[model samples]
Target: MPDGGLDPVIHAPARLRVVATLAALGPGDELSFPKLQKLLDMTAGNLSTHLRKLEDAGYVHVTKTHEGRTPATYLRLTGAGRAAFEAYTTALTTLLRGTAS
Candidate 1:
């Protein structure tokens, strides 16, 4: 959603849902992988694939650590990500409004 355009990366349906969910969190807040998966109703592999793409695009930050013996993965949107999502929404809204009768 940079340069006043839609982001093909975030435009994908699953990725859009992921970004929307993460965007709902407060800045610097994080969501556990399981929690996000449950929230989005996405299988582990499906979510992982999309997340990997977002991370590669520098829109998502993924952290891996240990909670006792269990491994934990947490996700948050980067500043660029926040900006991109904002732009995406603005563009989408504009597009929709233009089409409204």
Candidate 2:
């Protein structure tokens, strides 16, 4: 939980999970759509919809490319996304700290 309630912009379940996963990866790291779908245990369509939402909010970057004869999609978090995620974590930490007193 966070103070003043979680920011809806980052509080969305799918979006929150997406940001958490991205935060766990290395810098300049990226994940493929299929890989992410598997990791999140979500349907392709479901994951696609979530990803689109994140992309629209400038929280994630989606890249579509061709790999020989096949299509490849990569997802990564933007700088703004990273900052927001960090803030979310910090808020959660602060809230927990208050409870620990």
Choose the strongest candidate by TM-score. 1
Q: Write the per-residue lDDT of candidate 2 for residues 1-101, one digit (tens) a residue.
A: 44444556778788788889987887568999989888999899988888888788787888999999999999999887888888887777867778533
**TM-score between candidate 1 and the true structure:** 0.92
Residue 98 shift from truth in candidate 1, angstroms: 1.3
Q: Which stretches of candidate 2 lie over 4 Å from their true place?
A: 1-5, 99-101
Query: In order, what lDDT does every prediction score?
Result: 0.92, 0.81
Report how far off residue 19 is in candidate 2 (Å): 0.9
Question: How badly does each model clash, as a count of residue pairs?
Answer: 0, 0
* Model 1, span 1-101: residue lDDT tens: 34347798899999999999999999889999999999999999999999999999999999999999999999999999999899889888877777522
* Deviation (Å) of 3 in candidate 2: 6.0
Q: Note the residue pairs that clash in candidate 1.
A: none
Residues forming the 10-long window of minimal summed lDDT in candidate 2:
1-10
